[model samples]
Target: MSIISMGTHLQLLIHPSRSPIPHRGSLLQVADHGVRGHRHVRAHIMAARKAIEGVSDELNAVASQNMDFAPARRRVRTAFLPVQQQLNHVLFKMAVPEIQMEERYEKSSRGVEIFWKSWRPGQGEPMKAALFFCHGYGDTCTFFFEGIAKIIAAAGYGVFAMDYPCFGLSEGLHGYIHSFDEMVDHVIEQYARIRGMEEVRGLPHFLLGQSMGGAVALKVNLKQPREWDGVVLVAPMCKIAEDVTPPALVLKALAIISNILPEAKLFPQKDLAELAFRIPQKRKMTAFNAISYSDQMRLRTAVELIKATHDIESQLEKVSSPLLILHGAADKVTDPQVSRFLYDKACSKDKTLKLYEESYHSILEGEPDDRILEVINDIILWLDSHSTLK
Candidate 1:
């Protein structure tokens, strides 16, 4: 994906083979033709790159000492997001003319300004249902999900997503999770208002979660078992793979330290893009997710993630909503076996699971275009079948 400034606007271009719709001719052009726009975008990219490079040395120094420099990191991320978001693989150069999209920030009950987005079918198109998304840790719904939401909305469903407090464009410390449960409550509160909108008030609603967001969806279902009509999980993080988890003693120590320094960025870091994206090109594009949380895990955030997984594991049998679980069999970040475990333990009378043979954790955004479409089509099929159920 590359950004080209055309006159006053930035245009995004995607390689032919990477285009989500294979039938659409190669070279997705997203901006009006303008040499001036190209110069503007080039300059913007250069400036953002320089700013990021300036902070590299300081970030490395802080990392070596296992100290928190989140504020500095956040500033760089904020500075680079405008350019980065334009280069997102799924979004760059993609067009969804049939879908109408809107972005806004709403004041949550807790007084935090929550950033959210919605995609609905164009005027005169009858709504089918509503799909509320729970984005993964380190992810903002405004990036890859932007293209995804449009696809679903084009299929006649209303799609909604929000950035968790502190994550993405939302207000709060970047990558700092004070309490997992409180975060869940914030999601519930915000989604409830969207669900109540007159446009979708009486429609069936489903929850779709990827990675850590999968755990969020599960918790939401558990908290209000009868609220959602179904759930779609993509490589869910029900149990953090053992290899990725810290040693027992290390986890114990981290838990102890979290009580004192909940926001400290002391946990280990890993190249998650490598583990999650199977296609080399797609993996490389992950670098453009400017607002994603790529730093070391915060002390409390790590502990809370572990605890949330454990809690979900124990309550799997209680999951009664209709479920559609899609996982990459070769996923190493989150265990594919755990997705299997979820399939077996979920008490939903209607449940389905599809495992891609050599795919990685990010089936939707990291797989071949055909595979990504396959997963998406599967989700739509399942939702279509269940949308009529009371």
Candidate 2:
């Protein structure tokens, strides 16, 4: 029999002398398989064993209880997901510092920083009409347009897409919430201020706002007003049904809680990362693997995205610009009702609602590239027809 010390390096004895031990597991054995990430847990156990074994193994009853802290760990994870989503929403969209997207640049304003890409046609000198793109929450606009730039540019429009503040090549900060009025009045004004070069100020301008940007475009095109050829909104998140509580609420709640407890973890993305906005018609490609990791889509701190959502029912009457609301009938993100609502309610004398039976939330960049191209051509044709008519 051997005696072991309690506080110093573990003492090893040749024989066991205990009649009964509370923590009766073997000194070198482990229960349950390893966690996916902490593959080195066994090593950690072995390393700590040299120091902790000195205490009577009975004490391990208390230590083991502390080891399997499932409830506590769960609470910790629950809190972390939201905050992480916010930071990553900006980081994942930008240059990523570690992995570079095709085209990247930084722009700053109002103590805010953003990243953008001004993709011109590779074949021609330049385009007369400009396609301004605004991305949704937690998405990089450049990535959304990745391989489709040539198709869009070929249609005689220079594509200028931007990652929202705190995303992509933009700066590092929590997501910034923008009111519809602010997006149109302030954000677009920021674009106009820098865009007002004598040579290009008078060019045909068209705004393409997707999801959150759609709401922004609607507000901007209506109030501030732009003499653009037309406005195209794809799957704008104007009105989300009550059945679905968006992550935006999590972001907002985090903003409030984080103010009080700066270090408190806000885990909104846990659910979002698991969700995917798929079109049920034939199934299309989504940017994030929603099926496998639905929470990944919720990778953004949703407060800003949430704030961008507004019911423009009364405001729709104010928009005078020609509008195009393109929505996927089977989108898992924004509902077709939104498209129906916009079409039935918009007062634009020349409003068009094109519902693609096979398209999803990412109408332009989903599974079948050819179909998206067709939509683009249809847009150009409509724009040309309207231009000729006017």
Candidate 3:
């Protein structure tokens, strides 16, 4: 769908209808091998970041004008269109003609219609394998992975992803994950359908996950030991990072409150875009990602995430799929050490871990161009090696 522009100083250029496109990666110019070159690139990023902040402040001001909620939201979204449009253009330019995308809604076992998207080689191209993805908390499969999926598809593998219930366009109270088991069940129910499809069957299947998704991938493997060939986790949350969790007393208080008011959105949810994205301009651009859940973490969801991570930690030895874990050395959102924990404790005979130095939570999208690309290249090489017919 296209954003309808309005009359204003910030005019969002009109474009063709948009689909599942990735972020603007091609915008960054690769720096030459010199300190001066690196500094010049950094200066450009800083300047663009300043401009993005200015626009964001203006949009926030427009939103706070005492208008009704719906109207105000519409105004804010409209104002943010230019930044969004710019990003879309970058992804569109990076489009791979060989990778065809299809979007549809699948009715979950719980009866909620979950959004699903797939990218594979265009018609007549033989598929060698499939990559099924589970996204992180407060994140959707639609936006962030748009380009990442394309990268995998370009590597001769089909990629399929679903936005969990309540996240992205899926139906539920926004930002709520009622029960982590049910969440896993939803992924299982839909994924089974994909696996049984005539086109999808017989292909080597793997699970790819990020942040909390890494835990989901692990659970999916635990639930069905023989289903997947391998699992790839990027900064997986095998356990909650110490700093992000509330104190024990506070958590007990929240648990009590959660039972009384499960929908209460009182947790001090940090602005993830700021914490996750290391590149300044990329971090600022996150403000314009209209579908991302930027609201405070609901008590119920927070409790469930904490519980899920704990459960995953205990069951690490039960993990049987070959594993590849990628993490940012300095990630504060999900401790890199927990990934180390998975590597050490898992029973899988073939498991690998790669840590990117000085990176943040969103290693796939938020890292510097070279760093992120290097990470993706690592994943691609791993998948290629794994997909070879034995």
Best by TM-score: 1
Weakest ten-residue segment in model 2 by summed lDDT: 13-22
lDDT, candidate 1, 1-390, per-residue tens: 111122333121111111110011112122223331332111000011212222355542332221123344445455555555556365454666677888888899888888888999999999899999998887778667777888888888999999888887777766678778889999999999999999989999999988788989999999989889999998887865444445567567667866665665543343455667777777766554555665545567777877787788889999999999998899766668988999999999989998999997788888888788788888888888988776
Candidate 1 wrongly placed segments (more than 4 Å): 1-91, 241-252
Models, CA RMSD each: 13.6, 18.6, 14.4
* Of candidates 2 and 1, the better by lDDT: 1
- Candidate 2 is scored at a TM of 0.60
Error of 2 at 79 (Å): 31
Of candidates 3 and 1, the better by TM-score: 1
Q: Is candidate 1 or candidate 2 better by TM-score?
A: 1
Task: For candidate 2, give the lDDT of residue 204.
Answer: 71
Candidate 1, residue 165: the lDDT equals 88
Q: How many backbone clashes does candidate 1 have?
A: 4
Poorest stretch of ten by lDDT in candidate 1: 39-48
> In candidate 3, residue 75 scores what lDDT?
53
Question: Each model's TM-score, in the order given?
Answer: 0.78, 0.60, 0.77
* Per-residue C-alpha lDDT of model 2 across residues 1-390, encoded as one tens digit per residue: 111212222121111000011122223333333332332112111112111232345432322332112233223223333433333221223231121123544444555445566655544355556667765554445433544444566555566776554433354322323233443554575557536755346667777777666776776676556556678887775664544433444445544643333311122121111112232221222222110111111112233333444445457666667888887776655677877877777767888888888565556644354566676677667655654443
Best-fitting candidate, measured by lDDT? 1
